[model samples]
Target chain A: MAPNGVNGSSGSHRFDPDFTRLVVENMGPNVAPRTRQLLGGLIRHIHDFAREVELTNDEWMAGVHFINSIGQCSTSIRNEAHRVSDILGLESLVDEIAHKLVVEGDVEPTSSSILGPFWSPNAPFRDLGSSIIQDPNPKGRVALMHGTITDLLTGKPIPGAVFDIWQASANGKYDFQDPENQTPNNLRGKFRADENGKYWFYCYHPTAYSLPTDGPAYKLLQLMERHPMRPAHIHIMVTHPDYRGCTTQLYPKDDPWLATDTVFAVKNDLVVDFKPKEGDPKATLDLEYNVILPPKDYKGKL
Target chain B: MAPNGVNGSSGSHRFDPDFTRLVVENMGPNVAPRTRQLLGGLIRHIHDFAREVELTNDEWMAGVHFINSIGQCSTSIRNEAHRVSDILGLESLVDEIAHKLVVEGDVEPTSSSILGPFWSPNAPFRDLGSSIIQDPNPKGRVALMHGTITDLLTGKPIPGAVFDIWQASANGKYDFQDPENQTPNNLRGKFRADENGKYWFYCYHPTAYSLPTDGPAYKLLQLMERHPMRPAHIHIMVTHPDYRGCTTQLYPKDDPWLATDTVFAVKNDLVVDFKPKEGDPKATLDLEYNVILPPKDYKGKL
Candidate 1:
């Protein structure tokens, strides 16, 4: 109408590709550089998608409704939008790309992963070699997890490096997920590295677990006919005053879900072996992982 | 990580563009054809945008927060999300593309426009030649609007074609928006076509008005340094059982906002001259427009 106005608005299902430019130009001129770049990219791509698909009016309205539902379903305790991002591998991809520069020469720093919804603030502090297994082996085999924290640049152990560790039980449930059987801090602990930067603790052998199945993300996965299982792994957040903190996850080498991790977060360097503990009274498996931290002041080449 | 898994997750801010294919692939096999096409297009475009911009974690998070705030602010009374869509000119684009095929032979049907948030059902049914100007001329000039409805294919006047019309007062405020100064349903009415398909009514001359200035859409306009005024116009909805309904707005040719209508909805055929009426006591301006309707079952070539 109005001779297609300013953008050659036409009477066809397909939009003129240059309409993207018109949309960007209409944003006026007060925008900051970064905002302009981001908004411009989004406008071009979104319009491209709509045009490529030849999205009908009903489909566009449906998409809008889906977005509104995601907002309605999201809350502080259950961030449905974040869950959607995770399921789509957006969060994982972003974290990986953001932290990719944390390397010293050819040696890459420990790859960070999604901090899944199970983590809580202020984990219970424990001794260097104390166990995080507050509950008796009520559901699965006992495991001893040990690791060393080192500087990615110096390739040397960092003593007194503070780290937080938490994982789901062998039954595939976190402490909070199974309130009746697990103790308050079961399989969750905070520890400091010893003189040699070694830290060990006892916990349950991890197992794959299903994400919440009640939200829109779950419904989307169902539509895709995809499962919602995350691979068995231990969550780690290691830090020191001289190093940049790294929040990563360690996936056992042979976990079935690793190849199809629902979150797409299994980095090769983060996979480790879980050997059998030879002669321990309270442990059955020995799980070992090592963490590498970047210098606090490190900046990648621009 | 993990040899890029199935999609080749890489370590660059510019994501491996093919990762979009991988993201779409992960959607499994149960999706309907239409859903798959839509999702695939969206995944491809969204990923392309992220990669093209080399989006940072901070920027992504800011976008997520903005989406959450939009959901929180949206309601039946004030749909901030729709407001955002309107500001971005998305609604206009979709509506234009959807109605582009309503043509017969060489004649294009009346273009459809957005059903803006102010529309209400159950308007007072008035005589075809009566006045919709229930309130006194307390703001601006009185106007006489007259039009004929005809079938695009037959080129014959359509008798008994039902139509609804509404507009803001000369003060640029709708009746509901300015309750103290305007009577209920002032400048709003439902009317039927006469034997000759002619319709006429007296109402206030329409004028420009600003959109709500307190929402995120308003704030975004502030960031873009763009004005929020909409051009002077009257809303019209014409319908008949044997023809497709058309919802459109008429923009006066000389309105200052026509060149840069905030919503980008001015079609050339929808703009008309608001001429000065001669020797008329009840009206000063004369507004005339013709409506065209397509057959209800008409379908475009696939």
Candidate 2:
């Protein structure tokens, strides 16, 4: 017979509903309301998912290991896990999904994405018509980019909008993540548009690059037998206190991997032509970027 | 109009199904069959969970942070995150539910709980008739414990089983984690049963204690509004060269926390009575214990 405990408190082994009750009864007494709500929703979702999958022990442990490696691979130069997020298109889908909600500026679309592992606090400021490129060591043809940022409805430029841009060099490397390159900042700079919402910059045509395939995310990809390439693009973060902040990338027209960018950041409104200037002594390019400010007196914002 | 890329690649962004596809596809390469199967299944479960909850960006980031704190909370004496697991009952549920499926052998009829963060590898081995207590602290009335390891089918006692027992003092502190009290080996030991499947030891009755709540797990629980207490119990890791391994615990009968053990470790067959025996020399002692052996022909198989 199964052993019995004092006062007959222990009897047949049975599933206690206590687990569910305990969890609900014990979480978050001091958290902010929004955070509490978010955590509560997350716990519910995770629990429901576990139930739906009937996840096993080994499988759960594997998730633990995968997450562990994500932590290990997070360095100043690389965030392999974030790269995985990009490859999965989580960053693009959640942050860059343009909708009526965003265009109407019902919610302030703060720049959101993986905060890619390579970002640093040191970004030198440049003028409206300044060249961001320093030491043009493996330089390609120079291109001049111009854009007019205006209120979507009024077609008026939101002068003085700060435009931050960075891109892969012709050799497919960002200045921060690559250590072999010089340190003073290359292919990355911040620019301000003039009062007319007009601006231009001198930089080489960006090239396509492969996401890092040497870390745990790579191990994961190898385990799944998948590719690790992203389309050619220039990374940009557009921000101002008044208008919604936008973190996006502009994809080049002729990159072979455009359709398969590991981060899935290509957005139609964001992509612009990097036209080749014909013997005009200058590579002139022009595009219009509109910013829609949040409406006055509206409170339910993102 | 939605702008198009020069190469005519559609830049229109939407939440693509390809995101989920890429996540599963890029996990790990050529792992063990069992590992691959497990990770693959888990990835699917996490994905489904995220979708079912319509997981938002903010919520997902919270999960990442929660996990990060869990890792941060891990130390030599505390692992509150695991306690969070215990409080959620995931630890006990997993231990009891899926352990056999992954590795099967001598199944212990008793209930098992989490391996709390305090167990140390330096426990001093004690002989059969010795007290587990070395320090004069957390005193409780000593009582003799006796039992026979018999087969449920045959009702025959099995001899030569080794039973390892460890528990906190009456004050709820394990020796190693408590620096204010005493030296290394205190209130902890291991005992082996004789040919009759019988053994005894010395120690006061274990008392319930709150789990470590000063770390990140505590912060999480505070956020979750939960307590950090576990019911009184004695851990038993029973093994014999020929019998199946059983790592379990015996909880006290009248524990107030029985219904609410933070780690969800209460099992039905695992509870044992601490009867107050009639006035005898053994009854006045500081500690007393007993043991039972495994079945014959039960070679230790993992």
Using lDDT, give the best candidate's number.
1
lDDT of 2 by residue, A174-204 (tens): 7765658745578888888788866677776
What C-alpha lDDT values do all the predictions have?
Answer: 0.76, 0.57
| lDDT of each residue in B116-173, candidate 1, tens digit only | 8677686898996789888875667787888999988888999999889988887788
What DockQ would candidate 1 receive versus the native complex?
A: 0.34
lDDT of 2 by residue, B126-242 (tens): 887677766767366564545555442344545666666677876788877676875677766666667876667766677888776666556766666666777888887766675
- DockQ list for all candidates: 0.34, 0.19
| Fnat by candidate, in order | 0.41, 0.20
